[model samples]
Target: MNELPSRAHRPVRVLRVLASRHADSTRMVRPQDFDTELVAQAASVSDVDGHERYVPLCVDWRDARLLLSRWDDDCAMSDVPFLYQRQRRTATHLLAVPFEQLDAPGRAARMTPTFIFSIGRCGSTLLSRLLAAVGEQSVSEPDVLTSVAHFDDDAERAAAQGARERIVQSCVAAFEPACGPAPVIKLRARCNRAIDVFLNAMPHARYVFMCRDRDDWVRSSSRAFGDSGEALAELLKASVEAFDRMHAARVDPVLVWYEDLLADPVRALRRILLARDDLDARRAAVERALRTDAQEGSGLSRASLAMRTGDAGALAAFGARWREIRPERLLREHGLSRLR
Candidate 1:
């Protein structure tokens, strides 16, 4: 004879039980899939029907947009376990709405996001990963910003600013719900070229520029760039100069060095998090980032190895002509770097 369970006990038992559903693979998502409450966030620009269109990367948190970049096509049913923890649902197929279909009201309500721009082969990726440990949705090296930075004309750049803001607003609506109220985006290093143009669009956005020791950067970049190593160094130098100028002018930007991050990543990250006012979970996130191999699969690490071992290919790429570009006058004026 078995005792009858109470209503509460039955519900608990039911929750503990596992069941599977046969989701229809052929089911098409209609316009009804999205609405003002459920809007798509701009993940990337794609070609649809021979015209450039915005694609939804993830769903906004109000109803939860599927983060497309995190989804794997082979495992269509898989969801980011960290995300949608309560829902237990994964987006098997994505539904992208026209740019005009995105919820305008939602975009206006989103928080301003942070930006991370760095010299090539710096610790930008590692910083992004560390930020993720703290539950921040970090997008590392997005191509969209790089493309936006290519517009050189002042008028054209000004025009692009509006479009850029709209895209960012959509991205914020989509990613912030999952990453944090303020999502952090790490743009391609080249975006440094158009930093002002970008900042104009999102005037209040927080930004950080990462750099490395001159010798270290030169050695690392030379390995891959060959004859262009000097040019790469010049670019890095220019970026640092521009960043220093901004800092001197009272622009709210932070300058981070590769050496400092490597020596004490937790401390380094804490500085940025504190500056950004996102220090919640700093202790646990720093611990997790430090406990794990932060530089796993990092191309920068590989380049450093090549430089140390004196690989012939690396030597050839780096070439024999190593030139030390002058640090920006602003850096010297501000006493920013120890590199002489």
Candidate 2:
């Protein structure tokens, strides 16, 4: 029999090495856990604009598994899964695998994760939760993307490109299904201002822009924010502004109404997912989500908001500003031209 090739000459299994090293425990990050030379980088970052940034991350090439670590100064890592956290007290020899090293292109080549941009107080959380039930990965609110969206200057723009890869890695790490689509990233309402920034980075990425009907939106928002005049105005402005930017960027997003989704969750989800072949594979997961009752769990559901009659009054107060912004384009984009 021919002699086997020397281990040194053989292809290095990067992902397997990282996973095996860290399999024993989840504790302090270990340098040896990563093939640093392959792609040496840090996983720690400070909070950006009061939002927690993702800790440094990398991908293991051997098994193609993603890895991340809790940074000493990063508070955002506190809420992440226990494996990613640094448990200083325990005498565990947890090796921190550098997840940032493996920023290889097309890691999630089969599926392009969807982006869900919504008006606040809509049923986005519920929709995200439902998607999760159907084997879809959903990152509801992350700090890194928010910071990336605001990038305008040269340095910030370059940084946004790197940040985009890391964000994709984070989603890769969060994804658990053996063979499903990429994760859905649901942006906070505030990020609506920089929606184009994100779209520019992932040009082919599909998106869904969700909103409640004007009346329901005003009512729900007023209940959430008591002094609702300015806030309500901003909400409407952002909703319209997002569409304008989408049109300018030529980012065609499917518009979903909260009430319509509630009425028929299955069909609504299918309409959104069926937009792409990869997403269509999640049919079973969608079925499971349909059966799931909305409740106060996993930060997905909240007690239903009571309709506030004062919503009409609040809208009246912002009448001038509201009229100044043209909503006809948005109305037509979502097939609500009849409203226009």
lDDT score at residue 112, model 1, on the 0-100 scale: 64
The alpha-carbon deviation from the true structure for residue 265 of candidate 2, after best TM-score superposition, in angstroms, is 1.2
The best candidate by lDDT is 2
20, model 2: CA deviation in Å? Answer: 31
Instruction: Show model 2 residue runs off by greater than 4 Å.
Output: 1-111, 150-181, 275-313, 333-340
lDDT of each residue in 1-340, candidate 2, tens digit only: 1111123221222221223245323222333443322322223222112112223333332322333333334322212222122322221222233334333335544457677888766777678766666545565544334443444357545434434544553444334232245567676676687776566545567788788876666666666555365566666677667866776777677878888887977667787777545445666666666555443322122443333334456666555555666476676765654222
TM-score of each: 0.58, 0.56
Candidate RMSDs in Å, in order, are: 15.1, 12.3
**Any idea what lDDT model 2 has?**
0.51
On residues 1-340, what C-alpha lDDT tens digit does candidate 1 reach at each position?
1111122211000011132132221112222332222223333323222111122332222222222222322421111212221112333334433334344535535566778888766777677777777656676654434545554357645444435545445554555434555667786666777666555555566788888776666666555344265466457666776686466546578778888877876677777677545555476766676566444433334443565432344333333332345554656765555543
Candidate 1's C-alpha lDDT? 0.50
In model 1, the clashing pairs are 57-68, 58-66, 59-65, 59-66, 137-179, 222-318, 226-317
